[model samples]
Target chain A: MIELLLTPLHYEYMIKAIVVSGVIGGVCGLLSCFVTLKGWSLMGDALSHAIVPGVAVAYLVGLPFALGAFASGLLAAVVMGVVKSKTRIREDAVIGIVFTTFFAAGVLMISLFPSNISLKTIVLGNILGIADSDIIQMLAISAVALLVLVLKWKDLLLFAFDPNQAQSIGLNTTRLNLMLLILLAATAVAALQAVGAVLVIAMLVTPGATAYQLTDRFGRMMLLACGMGIVTSMLGAYISYFLNGSTGGCIVCLQTLVFLMAFFFAPKYGIVAARRKARRTTDALLISGDAHPVPALRGL
Target chain B: MSHGSTKLNKNDISSEIDLHVNEVTVAYNNGHVALFDTTFDLGAGTICALVGVNGSGKSTLFKTIMGFLTPTRGSVTIGGKPVQVAQKQNMVAYIPQAEDVDWAFPVSVMDVVLMGRYGYMNFLRIPRATDLEIAIESLRRVNMLDYKERQIGELSGGQKKRVFLARALAQRGRIVLLDEPFSGVDVQTEAAIIELLRELRADEHLILVSTHDLGLVPSFCDQVVIINRTVLAAGPTHDTFTQENLARAFGGTLRDLRIDHTDAPDGTSNEFRVLSDDEEPLIFGHDGRLVDHWHPGIDEEESK
Candidate 1:
């Protein structure tokens, strides 16, 4: 272990992976809170997959992958937003339509290229072999995304609860929504480089959802989720390193474990704990004859 | 079809008008008009009930006032400024329809209320101590202080509505717009909410509530607006709740509002009747001097 740590290549890869994963996880976790709250879990997945055409297009045009992915994701988000806003159709239905169409287009684009870079590998990602440049780019994008979200935190929260209220209060809900959708697309693009489209959804949802079970305060939930993200990333990276498996899969597995634990054990909002508490209270009331008074229980 | 043909009842009116929406028209994207050339005035320091048949533009008018919908024609001015400017010009709080929300989202009563102050706080900053204090105060006002830590998903419909009210109260807005605030509330809770509205109005907060509770207007509200695609009439509750106005507001489908009558101790006449005969029949009551019928039958079911 000591020798491995001292080896220049080993040290560099380990450091690079940890830093990149930690930053990506933390940022995605924070954004995921908003996504989950807005019932946009599938939206995140859709946007993630929607980036392939952009990346493929960028790759074909010899441009940066991030730029390509960002553009494609933005296009998908905008299409989704416009369709949902203008139509009587449900938002999920719109999202389903947009993602499938865009993802299929992306697949066709990749097939047209027929390069050594296969669709399966790029779509799923090769997290273990992430280049130093990719790591740097991922961390930078994540940091920028986090900063933007922090700056617009209040606006975002207001938009999530009641967009009309936000608009009435002089917040341009349309502009703000566009800004958030773009940010979400950008974040999806960044996370895709590290975790692939499939697993990025997990990073965006699981930590925030689990954190939600532990706290009601948005600030607390965001902070707790960031912490959960860091832990999951570190543990997943380590597990993959030792088990000789896919890092992205390992990260999602760890996140699943954390979510399961929180689901059963978290206080206040946890399913199992809440049920137990309700049962205990009912039993206590019944034993104390509090519920025995028929009129009291049934009438005003 | 004649203009000003319907005379408003005059028993339940206050003095000054606070919110005046004149000739406002809103159209959906699909070319359907929700509100057309609507005109109504809500009195200051009074609870004004808005009564109309479903899809008759009641919610559209409320949404317009809240700046959620932009009217295609005419104007909506709160206090004095246009509704668009008034949204930020003064303190304005809105309680949306109960069913318009997704309750499964992860949020708490306190969390929802605290969001009211998000307009006042810096974009990036979290709620401060004062914000929290106001949230708590609002919760206390609505008698939902005990449920502050409870998740929104876990709350009953009435509890959720109260939490929404607390949020509006925390906004500290002088003009409040409420959409179907009593839809799923029990009588006790409804009464409690009405009492809170009374107190708020006493403090000179302009209260505009869009509701199906037409009967409560005689006793609880100072004024009423009868709308059906366009404004039928607007005035004191007693003046506006006439049989003619009710007929126009609900269309001719509502008949002979004299279903049940109770003579008051003060010699005032109170009449209760079915406003509509749908699966959920709308029931309303009038204090004889003024005929008002718009009590939401859905609320009665919740109490049972």
Candidate 2:
């Protein structure tokens, strides 16, 4: 078993791939907690896809791809916010409109420029082909983003829970909101190098949602999500090595598997556990000759 | 419709003003007025009730006081300072409606209450021992210290209200604003909140509560402010919360009820029956005094 695990370490490219994918998973997992709590899952999907045009444009203009991705992602977020607040359009509709437009623009740019950048790689990521500089860039962005999220998580939690109360306590909720959006864009840019645009949403949402089913506390939810993220990324990377398949695809599939496990097996909130609890309560009531047959419990 | 038709009773009001709304006017983005030229003053050691019908701008006034909405023409001040400055100084706290929060968010009851100290703590500094002690004391005051570790989502409606009340209490602010604190609460929880408000008033805290429960006003509040789109009357509850003021604030519905009462058989008993469109009629009796007592959902089945 040890030799099998160490087999991948023999290749320099494999080791680099593992490190880059792991870093992406961890940062995205940490952010997933906030996204899940705030019901910003669609926002994450929107921002990830919206950065495609920026990546294409940056490659065209000879600028750093991360910078362009961050700019375009931020612009998309701002536009979405304005549209939701200034008009009567619902948030989901606004997100859908903004992201699809940006994504279409990106596809058009790629076809127009006809560069070495492949549409498949941009849509589905190329973890094994990441250069040393790309690894370094990913590490820098992930470190800064994770550090800030760890340090100011409480304030962010309070803001997400209740913005009006946070403002009443003298916290600048608007600034906090803008800061969160910026971090989101940056995280999307960082993850873009690993999972590309389309599959990044899975990385940004699944870990926190799975953790949410397993824990009732925010701090514990974050820790569990980070753990799940790292584990899935490493396992997915190893499995993909053997199958000769997409690492991002394997990672997202593994995350879904973990979520399914939690759905049925989590002690407090899982379907199976809830059924067991109901049975036990009913048995106790029957033994005591006090089973009144509650109408609500009948359905459960 | 006359401004200042009801005068402030100096003998009943304290000289020190804890909260002042000076001719505040709030308008929505579409140039529609929500609250027009409203003014009121509240002092320490008093609990004030903001009474108005639906769409009468009660929430707009509270939001303006909390600095969430900027007044178009006037200002809100606390302790002779602007609302923002007072908020920064930790002199004002607001307890929002329960429905405004995302209850499913993962947070402990203790964490929610501890958020009150965020105004006093320095940037990024965790709560100290003193902060925890104050939070615990606040919880104890609301009889919710035992459930401090429970998730907020698991709490009942009354428990949620207590948790929010504890949060406001933990702030130690001299002025606290509550928006519809008793809307969904049970009778026992309402009584508990009333008791807590009395205790806060004894500690010289000024409380402004917006409630649709008009029955609680005479018993629990010392002052009342009636507003339609503007301040109809603002003074001591016993002096300003008259039938005429209520009629003006509530519009023709109240006038119709008064007329229905005059046509009743027991007209000399000073009883008024308010018949809602959907619900049963509620009968209120005034025994030759300003104190009007009525029961909600009482004799409802019989009336039906």
Candidate 3:
């Protein structure tokens, strides 16, 4: 077991994959806290998928993939915003409509070009073969996104909790929301380097949600989530060396597993713990002669 | 139709105003006139009720005052400055509706209150020691100091209202606008909030509370501004909060009940009138003096 745990560090490709995965994971994790809190989880999914056409176009034009992906990600976000605001269609439905359309256009664009890159690789990225340039770009995007999130978290929390109050206090809620969107775009671009478009949403959603179930402080929730992301992505990447499997899938599966543990076992907010608490309350009430089999508890 | 129509010159108000909505007309992007030729001026040490029926431009007025909406024809000034400038100077505070806040968001009661000091904080919003002290004092004022570390989501509806009130208090703004503070609160909580507002009034803070609880208006508020797309009346509460003006403002929404006129043993005539807009009913004795509140569960005269 020790040898297996220590073996991945010997391989240069494995070390690089682990480091890149951990960095992107931490970035996505922190951003996911805001995404989940702002109820923008679907927006994360949308931006990730919507960048496919940009990547395809970049491949076609021989331009850098990060630039194209970032631009398309932002464009998709704007399109989603416009559609949701202009029409009576619900926001979730609008996100679905825009992202799928963009993704289909990307697939069509890719099909028109020579098959230098496999569609599978774009959709389910090969982190094992990430180029040195891609790693540098991903790390740069991660660092900048991390810095912005750290600097503006307080205002962003205010925006997420009560936008009306934020606006009332002279903070421009519209601009804050736009900043979050731009950060989300950057995160999607950074995450795409490791997890590809399809699995990026899990990386951007699960850590925050799992951390949320475990804590009641937004600051602590972000820290826990970032830590969860880094640990899980690193472990998944390392374990994938032995499993000979998809790194992104392994990372997501590990996150889902952590989420399940928190769901049932979190001290205060978990389902199992809550049920236990309820039973104890009922028992206490019954013993204390305060229980009544009438009114609210009559059916029971 | 009119009582103490205290419209003042723009220049006179610009200096002395705690809040001045001078002939403000707000139109929607589609050119629908939401608020038409509305005007009201208030100075310090006032707790005024902003009374209106739904869609009667109450929210539009609030939006304009908070600088969320631009008025087509008029301006809102606070502390001798424009709404935007006043807000930038941290002179405006708002307590939002319950629906406007995500109660389940992970934040402590103290965090919500400290948000009020954001205007004074640096760009990173690291709460200074003074900010923390003010927040603690605000929480103490609202009787929520013990719950400062508790998650805001863990609070009851009344507790939630108090937390926001504490937040407004911490803001230390001269002009405070509260949107439906009493809508979901219990009577005890309502009384407590009003008591706090009275203290704020004594401290010379100008407060505007938009509420549907008409019955409590005369009992607590010092002034009233009744509106229906325009200011129908604005002045001292007793003169402006009459049923006639409310009937016009509410437009058939108010229901009334009157006891038959009776001659007392002392030879003075006695009458009881109840006017309600389907909320807490207001009972008035002879000469429009607000009397004991009308409660469905209590037959007060018989009980007496």
> Which candidate wins on DockQ?
3
Which segments of candidate 2 are over 4 A away from where they belong? A1-4, A85-87, A291-300, B1-17, B253-278, B281-304
Q: How close is candidate 1 to the true structure, as a TM-score?
A: 0.84
After superposing the true interface residues, what Cα RMSD does each candidate give? 2.3, 1.3, 0.9
Residue B54 of model 1 has an lDDT of: 80
True contacts kept of 1: 0.52
TM-score of chain B, candidates 1 onward in order: 0.78, 0.81, 0.85
TM-score of every candidate = 0.84, 0.89, 0.90
| Candidate 3 chain B minimal-lDDT segment of 10 residues | B1-10
Q: Please write out the lDDT profile of model 3 over residues B1-304, one tens digit for every residue.
A: 1111111122224434468889899999777999999988898889999999899999999999999999999888887688887787667889999888888888999989999888778889998777888899999999999999999889888999999999998887778899999878898999999999999888777899999989899888999999999999999998999867887887667666665445456756666666666754556766788876653422323110
Residues A81-184 of candidate 2 have per-residue lDDT tens digits of 89888889988999999999999999899988877677887898988887677678778889999889988888888898888878887889988888788788
Q: How many backbone clashes does candidate 1 have?
A: 9
Predicted candidate 2 versus true structure: per-residue lDDT over B138-191, tens digit per residue: 999999999999999898899999999999888877788899999789999999
Per-residue lDDT over A116-140 for candidate 1, one digit per residue giving the tens place of the 0 to 100 score? 4567756877666776666666777
RMSD of each: 8.7, 7.6, 7.2
Candidate 1 chain A vs. true chain A: TM-score?
0.89
Estimate the lDDT of model 3.
0.86
What digit string (tens of lDDT, one per residue) describes model 1 on residues B178-202? Answer: 8888888899888888888999889
Candidate 1: segments with Cα more than 4 A from true spot: A1-9, A81-93, A114-120, A278-300, B1-17, B103-106, B125-133, B143-147, B152-160, B252-304
